[model samples]
Target chain A: MTVYEFAKGLILEAGGQVRSRMDESIQVETKSNPNDLVTNIDREVENYIYNSILDTYPDHQVIGEEGHGHELTQLEGFSWVIDPIDGTLNFVHQADNFAISIGIYKDNESYAGFVYDVISDTLYHAKKGEGAYINRQRIKTVEQTTLKTSIIGINPNWLTRSKSEAIFKQIVADARSARAYGSAALEIVNVATGKLAAYMTPRLSPWDYAGAAIILEEVNGVVTDLLGNPLSLIKPSSVIAANPQIHEEILTHYLSHHNEDISAFHQYLNSK
Target chain B: MTVYEFAKGLILEAGGQVRSRMDESIQVETKSNPNDLVTNIDREVENYIYNSILDTYPDHQVIGEEGHGHELTQLEGFSWVIDPIDGTLNFVHQADNFAISIGIYKDNESYAGFVYDVISDTLYHAKKGEGAYINRQRIKTVEQTTLKTSIIGINPNWLTRSKSEAIFKQIVADARSARAYGSAALEIVNVATGKLAAYMTPRLSPWDYAGAAIILEEVNGVVTDLLGNPLSLIKPSSVIAANPQIHEEILTHYLSHHNEDISAFHQYLNSK
Candidate 1:
């Protein structure tokens, strides 16, 4: 089977496994901080995907959220970036809105990507040089719209705690409306599908956005750090994924004026 | 038929009509402000529901989001409150996450309430003395969870613009996480279903919380203005809907410390 086919099949199977496991009591734990949650299902799903990839393509490397493939950092050859459960807090609390995301890379270039909304049975996937699809139905590119006519997704915490808090607060006021779904993958998918004009965050890891970056790019959406720089596939960075128009507008009008604040934030992120 | 049965049937049918009309080109307009959006579908659905209610119970009064029943002031007899499309911006842009909300009242008391999620076809409804349901499945009362272990939903705008910004900022920081779904009705439903520990806003119309208040109360959830006062059935007010434990804790610990800020905000809302 082609690499895309194998990845798609594995993600679907993993989603099914997650759905079945939801009925049983979930064991929860925290990492990094008290609010950052992880569940037994997340580790189990990651392990299953990691083993399955090694068994099928022994030469391919894997990097996952649960640290199964953390040692293999460089995307030198064929590598898979996986977030077994993209929204662990949502998964544990709401039992909905979480997703399993996977991105396949060849020599640091995106090859294929998939984000499976397990509860909704919706799969958003794309391959290099090809268009994106939601459950096998092709999705249209985001229509051109301005900030005043758009709906953006942003976490409320950023508006309160980020170094560029004032800048983000202005952006929230300027936009037509704002929503926070608490899932980066789903918010990025919403941008690709034209549901949200933009989705921004102060920081996101590779596994949090790798799959979504591929799908968004396929549909003419732009994914970049807050400084308008391309995101690193090997490290966490501040992210802003939006349609082409809003992306440029925000970078120019909003983010450009506050370089000092944004730089400070990025420097803080790097220090961490 | 009983008021609950008739209201549920009409809401389901209205949801069907709204879904069918989504395929057509929508006419958009703003009410009160540029960000406040309304669409042709909203008017059509409200009109349908208003006419259907009057045709069935001519003596019953109706109050709708659109101006269909705005003149009706006193809820001395049987009354119906309707928000044909609760999340107009979502309906216009994302085409999902919006809902149809209706609450039936008799002499200022809740008789029945229904909030239909059109895209998913899930109906959350409740009668005064009856327990709440989701598409006929009985939902449990909100589970006991602390602020540090709970997920609450609050519009980010409140954190930026309200008089209680600093207080709300603290509340958000103290919570495990915060989410904003952009629809008051759906957010309140999330509180009732225990998907969200609490949902609060600076101000919301009676139509916004009328339906959700009944559903939440049926599930042993508390619905009140931010100051812990009961919501009026004929006017707008600040809202905080939560499980019993969180409700008491938040009011006692957080909001009570800053009554001046909250009251000033409420006064501004009343002035508007």
Candidate 2:
């Protein structure tokens, strides 16, 4: 099978395996701090995908959350960054909401991105230079939607972090409403589908965004840093993903009202 | 058919109707404040359910979100409290994470409850004594879970609300981790299935808690006012719903830590 077909078949197969074991007992462990959880299932699922892909393409590079894959200096040819379970806490505790994420980059360009919301059996996929799709239907972000006409997704954690607080509060106070769905990738997908006008998460990792970043861009949506600069696929930044028209509106309002402390926090993170 | 059977049928039909319209062009509106949203779809779904139930059981009382039915007083006799789309904001924005909530109470005792997550096609239901089920198999709260093994769900708004700051901070310090899902009924259902250790929301309306409150109780879970008192079915409260063991830990460690202003807020609401 070709690489794309092989990845698709393997992802669905791995997802099916997970569904069968949904009701079985699990061993949950903490990561980083107490609030972050990792389950044995996450590791096993990642391993299954990793081994399957490696068997198909022996020379390809992989960066996986389970730590079982190779790490390289730069993205050269074919590289896959996999988040076997994107919402691990949602998986270990609720047995749902977690998803399997896989993205393929060819020669430092996002080639294909796939996010399978396992429990719901919904697959959101995109190929570079092609339109985004859910089950093969074309998707596009909504246009000309004002803040009052839009529903924005935000991270609740951003509400308290000093750097994100003032701007975040102003956006919430200005928008028709704001919601936090707990999954950065999924929320961006919502924006691409026009289900949400925009999505902003102040803290995200590359794996958390790799898939949705490509999908949103394919649908004519924009993703940027908080200061209205372009987002790089190499690292995570304070993300603002929205339709192009409202992109500047969000950033302009955010910067106009940002306080000194908020700017200081951003400076601190940039230094790191 | 028995009352239980009839209610189940109604719930399934209404759920299917809501699902079929998921992708239709929608007209959205804001409610009460810019931070809250109401949709034409929300009103349509509630009206559809309200009319269907009233047409079938003309004598039954109905309390619905759109104010389509009578003004709610006490939960007397055969009353059906419905939140046609419990997470209107999620539905309007994410097109997911929302559900059809229905609660059947006979003279103040919960008789049957259904929270159908239309997108996932998962129906979390209980008949007071028949035990809780997710797609017909019996389910229980996470077994042997403690605060350290738990992830609590709280609204981000609580962090900024003056009265909730201390308790909110204490919860952040206490739980292994925390999240804000933006749906009260769904969050309560998460507690029923052990997806979350606890779900704390400072303010809720009866329509928001009616359905999941019943299911949570059937799974050996507890939903009480922040002081650990039983919830009043007719009025919303500062709620903490959890597995019995973890419930007390949250009450003592987090809820109790809030000073007089928060307690007064709770008491002031209860008196109303």
Candidate 3:
């Protein structure tokens, strides 16, 4: 099978494993800190994907959030980076909001990515040079919807910490709506699905943005640093990914309010 | 059937009706302001409950968010106050987070209530002096949990406006986690399910808190004004509802930061 086919098969299989496990009471463990968590379901799901992929493609490398997989230096050749459950805290609390995210890289470049919001049964997938897909139908980033007409997904952390609040307040003032779903991976899926016109976050880790980055870009959406530059897949950065029109408008009007912070945000991106 | 069963059945049936209609495109109209919205599905759902109940109990009074039902006064005899879509913003944006909530009262006292989060398939139900249930299984309110070990659901507005960010900051400084789901109805449901230790919000109307109020109380949780007095079914107020111990700690420490606002809030509640 082609890598995409193998990836999709594994994702669906892992998703089913996840679905069945939700009803079973499983022990939850704190990861990194109390705010972050991982359950046996996460490891079980990740192991299923890892074993399936390794048996199918032994040469391919892997990185998974559960620490059940490798720690990679370079993203050379075929490498699969997985986050078995992307909103783990939400999953621990609500048994929702968590996503099974997988991104495939060939020769250090993203080839395909899949993010399945398992509970909602929505799968957002994309292959580079082709297009994005939500379920089966091919999808693209929505057209240049104006800021005032846009509904954006944001993380509440930025509302207080990052100087982005001015931009955020302006975005809220300009957009149809503003929301924070607490999951970067899922938010990117929403952006790709056209359910969200744009998504911005001041800081995200490489693990948080990798899967969704491939999907968002494949759909013709722009994913860039706060200063309006493309995101580096190998590293995390402050980002504004949106419909082309609003992305630029947001970059122009919203970024100007915090020109100093904008420059500093860019500097932080570069340092990362 | 008892009033509680009647209310639960109607609420679930109304929810199913709303969910079935969700796939079909419908005209959405702005309500109150652009930030708020109402769809034909909302009115249809509320109307279904209203007509179905009136058919059996013609003398019963009904109040609904859509304004399609009666303007309840004095709450004499049986009354059903409902919010067809508790989180219209979520419904409009995410097609989820919206819930069907119905609050039943007998002789000016809340008797039965149900809040069904259609998408999540979570049904939080309660009956006066009986208890609360989740998916028909009894669920008691969470026992006394320290703020340091608790998770809280807060309204974003309060974080930005509440004069004392102490409780907010303290909770962040102390709690296991903090979140804001943007739906008062769902937040209360979270408390009933023990997913959250407490829910605090300022400026809520009767329609928003009615169903949740009944559910939280049934679970052995306490719902009170910021001053630790019982919340009124009639007046809108700033609320801090939690497991008893946490509720007292939150009120004494966190809520006291805004002493000046308390009296004004009291006045507002009394005036309403």
The best candidate by DockQ is: 1
Query: Would you give me the overall lDDT of model 3?
Result: 0.76
Which stretches in model 1 have alpha-carbon errors above 4 Å?
A162-164, B162-164
The model with the greatest TM-score is 1
TM-score per model over all chains: 0.98, 0.87, 0.86
Tens digits of per-residue lDDT for model 3, A23-45: 88878887667667778888888
Clashing pairs in 3: B141-B219
Chain A vs. true chain A, TM-score per model, equals 0.98, 0.90, 0.87
lDDT for each residue of candidate 1 in B1-272, tens digit (9 for 90 to 100): 88888898999999999888778999999999998988888888889999999998999999998986677667878988899999888999988999999988998888988999999999999998879999979989788778889999998777677575766888887888899998899999999998899998888998898898899999899999989999987778989999999999888999888888878877888787
Give DockQ for candidates 1 onward, in order. Answer: 0.76, 0.39, 0.25
> What is the DockQ ranking, best to worst?
1, 2, 3
Ten-residue stretch with the least lDDT total in model 2 chain B:
B168-177
Top-lDDT structure, candidate number = 1
Predicted complex 3: DockQ: 0.25
Docking class of 2: acceptable
Model 1 lDDT per residue over A202-243, tens place: 889899999999999999999999899999887788899999
